[model samples]
Target chain A: MGRLSDRAAFEQYAAQAEQRWETLWSGDRWVISVGISECSIAKGALETYRHLELLLSDGHIPAVLRRVGCAGWCFAEPFVEIKLPGQPPIVYGWVTTDRVPDLLDALRRGELRPEWALGVRAGESWQGIPALRDHPFLRSQRRLLLEQAGIIDPESIDDYIATGGYRAFLKALFEMTPEEVVNEVKTSNLRGRGGAGFPTGIKWESGRRTPAWPKYVVVNSHEGEPNVFKDRRLLETNPHLVLEGLLIGCYALETPHGYNYIGGEHALALRRFQKAVEQAYELGLLGDNILGSGFSCHVRVRTGGGAYICGEGSALMYAIMGQRGQPRTKPPRSVEEGLWKRPTVLNNTETFASIPAIIRNGGSWYAALGTKESTGTKLVTMQGPVRYLGVAEIELGMPMRQLIFEVFGGLRDGYRFKGVQTGGVSAGPLREEELDVPVDFDALTPLGAMLGSGGFVVFDDTVCAVDFARYLVAFSRYESCGKCTPCRLGTPALVEILDRIRHGFGRPEDLDVIQYASKHIIDLSLCGLGQVAPMPLLGMLERFREEFIEHITERRCRAGVCPMTAAAPIAS
Target chain B: MEPTKSGQRVDLEPLRRVLEERFRPRDYREAQELVVGACQEAQRLFGWVPPEAAQLIAEHLGVTTNRIYGLLTFYADFRTEPPGRHFLWICHGAACYVAGAGRLVEFLQERYGITGQGTTPDGALTVHVFNGCLGVCDLAPFAQLDHHEYVGRLNLERLQALIAELQGEAQTEAADGSTE
Candidate 1:
């Protein structure tokens, strides 16, 4: 009964943290955790948390209330997890302030009622609630990056240490050479998760090989993509995991300086990450002679000014340098000449987050998870009208249909399954029949369905193909940085053409003009942003030509989305 | 608010202190790197970059006033002109588009009497079509109120209520700044 009194002591730092974790979860006291990321906070998570804390703060229930990161369950947000002594945790969703007292009362009575609970997680079912592994949304996902989300107090370095966070970095720092670390990542075959799918190991190898001193590591945490939120979620929930991964990268490259370029809009994430960095510094995990290993690494958090282009490699560096966040033409590609024209290791937040797991287990162990070409699990955020909408980590080779139908429970009751916008809004929509295709970057790119950042914006059948394509083209036109002529001019031209077609002014020859201009923009644009801008228009033109033809010839939007009657776009 | 000429005055004492304390640069080239950060800090303090404030930053950073002006003009985050007291941003990304943000945009434009980015005639509120996705598509058809609080699951009715609420707020916050 005295679980707290039976502490097994250890001298190692990670082992000491493990002991702390064991004591916390060893049924010494009841635990209450609330999801507190931006999404949940918007839905009154703070109010619910405050109410619950007030109720339990007196210690009358022998319970402790903790603030943890969100579990990517946006639909049922303001969720609260209650765990009794010797019982698995039960997550109650849609928990308002009014429900806090009732939940506390139930916990106080020593009988957790599961009628309002989402699921239970202790590797088995408890009460009437299903185990998390068996839950439909979680069943298909093998969560690695999000393994500790919602369970650990993200602001607490102790919780991170208990979960074996820096063991991988410690291993890399003490045992392995920088070459071995790069080789392990290369062996893991981890590609960039930030849309491009570049081989991360190869980039690391180059960063390692570049004969430059004072090498820098910049983790691009700026999520400028239209619909991707996985990076923010990672930063919020498992920031230490990403931090540990960053340390591994820095140690591998012998880098002394690191910068986390975060989006300014992500205030909560930035605050939490800044706190994590602070805690690590205090614990001797960061800064000179970390844990007395004679190796020093310092990480500073930098903020972006909400520029979409700043998420690009070169543009991100420029933004770090406090510029206008514009991209430059490549050739000295970041590895060779980056960050003040010095050799730099630039990778996405998710790419760095995957390092610890690869190093902890072998690189081959990480490689065995997904398809031969696209190995390792990917963090995918599904948006739109899906019933089970949220961010999730899924193995790379899973067919898109399983995620759409089986994992997410198809569209909501009234909506029909339309095409899924693979990658972000920048990539083209995959046809309904194309759902059978694997989500591998190479497998889908040939069909113009690159899994850019793994954000799938699913649309319902009610949306018109032409109008939707026109909107995507218009967004590209709006976000074009204007460094080059083709993207700056071509996006506007395509938008004008598409807008004309939607507004019943398109000529038959406009299609040919769009094709020619789109091809030129793809070929002539300076950066990847320009090259990818016309993808939706090009993809829609190829797959949904009939829809455009209908819009042009019959002057009709079959889905009733556009005016199609010579009416202005802003008509009330 | 932007500096209105012939002229309403803005004190540069506080900004000068900030530049000295936080943004003291080593050289001319490194000072160029501080352009965005300086402008960002200035925008936070004043809500929008006043030309005098830009000039002060220019002289402090040892760069030309035009350089700071170029940065302020280029980034979406910076606004050269004065902003309304209350800001309403509609998400214009793909998810919001599918969720009927365009309808909200049209309604907002018609009601506010401006498109793209503009303040109301009464100077109570500013409505801007946010350039990128605010990344909370879970609440598709969302808007950020004054930058942090998100008003999601929005319809025309809720947006009207919000605008009316903000206008009421600004009405109390008059030109003389008597209301606390």
Candidate 2:
């Protein structure tokens, strides 16, 4: 068999694999596929999986079962997808142990129950899936980030290969030099997706040129931001892409050790990631002399104990050292002093995933795909009142309105756009007036907001700015690591004042107090947490001062959304 | 491995059995440590771990309840609540206090008719306001529910809605037999 080249090669490989897959199905007389993601496990997907395994072992059914990752419809989990030789692939949602027999029977008869079949897959398009494409929740989505999700069996390396996986890594390793690899990334202008928009190549090159032995590459999957789901989806859907990036990173930085720091509560991501790492190691892709090359590196997976502070680079380093996750005063950053006090290059999963692509295609090619300042694609998790509430990989500097109206299918039904809380809770909210601004780090920063983690939370007119600010403040307060006085104490105090004002107890001077506290915390805090702690509240107060005063003076919430205060005297 | 000062012998057998029977079946090891770790964590959160908590851990770990409880008391992360439906955590830590989480805690006490980790008159909600940091300094003044969903910048009104929503959901789930 000749080596596969491109999409054509993939098609050929898919044809062959399909034939073999068909034979296995027809000869076996039964086949089962289960989505074994974290949420599914919690919902007894594993129990049902075990039950099927037992049935197969008992010779009650001849079947080959495979465990895949999340299909993105988390609301209905433990989703099962079945494909028989002559029958079309069908997906069943909310399957439990009690329903295993029915699923098995369906498999045996090659029958798909309409109630259980959430959708049918037809060459990258879905039908009979509740108007999935036109539905408000999924209307405006360009799913480059989630391209392979819910389609490929995440655990199968073959399935991944069949879908053009590792081609980028192989091309990078076999074809490009380390500096060339770095240059391509530089050209791509891919910034760090983990809140800070630090240019990824600069970080990589700095570590590469550090002249330090035992350099380290760290994958920050600690999605501590409350509203973000980009990294979670990436890890769950295409973990191998992350691993491939990590391997490339290890080669580029000449590092022997790599770690993926996943949040403790992200059970699904951790499971899939661990399996991917183990499989890679088994295939000799992760161990010494990978792909028969002289380069040698190994990857390790570490889990955080659900500390939001650990998402910060320094705090993440501390957590990996098995110590309390607290921020360290930085003169020597992670590029200088990181994990075990080594010169470490830390990039989030999304940032790392871009590297292989940059290497495979030239830097300029990747750069040409996006805007001049911000080159390459950015994975933005669109949430809140937006019609499409999932992750999408968009060209950087894409217009905000396009993302809001076209990509997100506009605001939810019967609601007008109030504003958007971009970059998660840490970012300042962007009002409707600022919606036309291009979505990039610099663009958002100039408007008193920032592109932090690419979490675009849409808000409609019904969302009260005071309550929104309060929600963000409360989130920040709970997630603050308490390493600094300002962040530790100032955030809660600000929340109280905001609460008082929202509850009709606000004095006019309270705004000044909040402003002072916001400035103090931003200036005095030890880490990113404190520095951006008051951003949401301050942003709202700055842009929507009338709303705040309305709550205090008239005891009314202008948006008619603040739960604490009464309606604004019925307008008359 | 040597046992800790608590006089609990380091029994790798139970751990190994659980790991083999449940986790290792799918070629997973060390990956499932979180299951065991969660038990120790629950204990740390609640002080005295409960048998049902251990059973829940076992259910997650794919092991027997007794084995899970043994591992729970053996290690340090499991906990059993005395009697409460709600776990209210107050952030007195630096970030939280700076963000006005203290006042929010006071507000909960004053308005909710429930203080600390006590149940409501209808036993529908239990409030547990503890002192800790949740790591969202930027969105400070936050609190968590059963370590799942986080509510930020809490006030009386938000708290009321949150409690009401939670109670309503709990009732609906009880009616539907859904495990939230």
Candidate 3:
């Protein structure tokens, strides 16, 4: 099923694609899938996959092996799935190279080694192993963006077209008006997933309202902030969904062009998204007069030069414009005067990807899912000492305590949970007391932690707050766009103070100095980068003040992680 | 002077392929839309964005050389100088930091005498402590070897072993060269 030339052509293609998808998914042959995700490759998934490929194709073990994207099962990577004709897909974790033959032998015998099995997809049990629905980590998650990640073959356009991927864009183009689509998104109450929780519909409407000749839509896949892996992974998992969403937004706004501003480090994702773009054009899902509509769409994939500041709206536009990625103050948001002063609607990979779901199920259906203010599920990446160190999509109102303890299976048995740095590097490692707070976009701000990009790195007993604070502060200083005086000057000054404190040369008055500097940096800063530059330090100081005091007065490293020397204040 | 590190004249021929193939911006507006791609291709063709390549980009796009150099300096991905034979990106993301990336970093500095962002003495490797998560936090406290291969669950011993292996490979290469 190639290009849908017209409405009838699209319908025929959709029906055939659905049938093809069904045949492929629940087909007669035994299908073996290994994820080609970065996380999977890191854990030696390729080697296992190669071994499996040889084993499956050798004719002794009759099966087919294909590559898929990471299913967000970080704790158990190199996981393999075996799907028989009648049975559900059986997922087994820790499928190392040596274990491939053993797994095949067991599969041949029509038995699953319950020890190796994580769960069974599409069914309740594979002999003894439980269903994925009953999975400990997966139970809480309302996965909209990551729903088809592990199951679908990310590199295949056929898999996407089969699994109800581009239907929303097609529907929007053929069935609904631009106004209706925009209204649906507005009704869904979907806020921007890329840090700033601005209403996505509002951002789009602003772009639509502007009489700019040519408007642009951006899928900000620049997962620049430290600890945020969701955007890149989402793109890698299913680039088509993101593209479809982008096209939908374009259709809603009647725009011609869209840009996928992918990070430089995310080479695999860039390639996949670029591939998806090519496939879309070939299928006529993208390009001029989609299903014979006047709305012509062309997506350009722009690889970032790895600036964290470019993730900022103005800086991103500036970077795209061949200008320095320095932020000019925003009265004219990207939707007003963006990308060479044209109206541009920029949303993150998560936000754009979620658009399909919102459009498919009307706006009210989405609005009813999450909190009153913060609607819809969020793609959150959990890292550090958590048992399941991966990404999971959770509802907005889910508590931090539940996310870390229940969903992620808490830290390791021996370690005590100290804190968790939610959002980004600028946000906190929130203390144990602050764990009960909801992971809402609006609610997390007051606690000095926002659901910014939805990546929360938990800190166990081993982490020394002062040292961690210093690392984060120094990182901010390093990444500071020299455009702002506060971030440029203040971050380095804060780093110095933290460094002094870490090295055991800190004076008692150093705390006051940090407080004063932090105030100026937070208050005087231009963009979010400068405003939140001192946040990690401030959050650390608020929660773990004793650690700092101990480092200062006693010259003691309580965690024994720091090199605290009882010396005079280090000269700047 | 070191061949790769020194400010010697490079062959500008390969840069033309990257420019022609990757970009085809019709006008200045189109060029403006594709600045990042142009710079990225320029960097990829040459190991780093040399002054010559920057000049070419500026000329091609009808922009100032300052703009190109500004981008090269601003983004952490681009380097003005040519990098070492191999790139070692040690992730210092929050996950890695909590999992003792500091210790591994200290170990590299102490054991191999690697300092800051500079290349090793023999020019075999250069250490890049990445500003953020490289999206492989599953393997925390990890270092990406040669940009693709990930050395997971990294510790002092594993790091030492990895260094020995690289050195062994280098010695083999050197011996092969001598034979040739």
State in Å the error of residue B89, model 1: 2.3
Name every residue pair that clashes in candidate 3.
Answer: A421-A428
Model 2, A1-572: lDDT tens digits are 43233434544665676666556556635456787654455456788888878877877665577777765554456777766656556677778788878877865674556677666554443344443344333444444446677667777666776666777776776777778778778877888888788899899989887777778899999887766766877888789888888988887787778989887656667878898888777655667766565677888777775567878999888766545678899969889888777899999998888776677667788878667877777887665545543456777887898877877667657777777777677767777777889887788897788888887667666667887788788768866777689998999999899778776777889989998988999999999878988988888887888888888888888766555543444233
How far off is residue A109 in model 1, in Å? 3.6
- Predicted candidate 3 versus true structure: per-residue lDDT over A445-524, tens digit per residue: 88888788888888887889999898888888888889879889999899888877878888899999999999999999
- TM-scores for every predicted model: 0.94, 0.72, 0.96
Best of the candidates, TM-score: 3
lDDT at residue B154 of model 3 (Cα atoms): 88
- The local lDDT score (0 to 100) that residue A253 gets in candidate 3 is 80
lDDT of 2 by residue, B102-176 (tens): 456666667665443455554455566543333332234556666455566666677778878867875775677
Candidate 1 C-alpha lDDT tens digits along B1-180: 442322357777777888999897676656876777788788778777889999999898888888788678767777777778877778876678778887888787677666667888887777888767776777889888887777998988998888888888877767447744
Report how closely model 3 matches the true complex, as a DockQ value: 0.78
Tens digit of per-residue lDDT, candidate 1, span A345-437: 889999999999999999999999999989999988887888887888889989999988877768988988778877675678888888889
lDDT of each: 0.83, 0.68, 0.84
Chain A TM-score for each of the predictions:
0.96, 0.82, 0.97
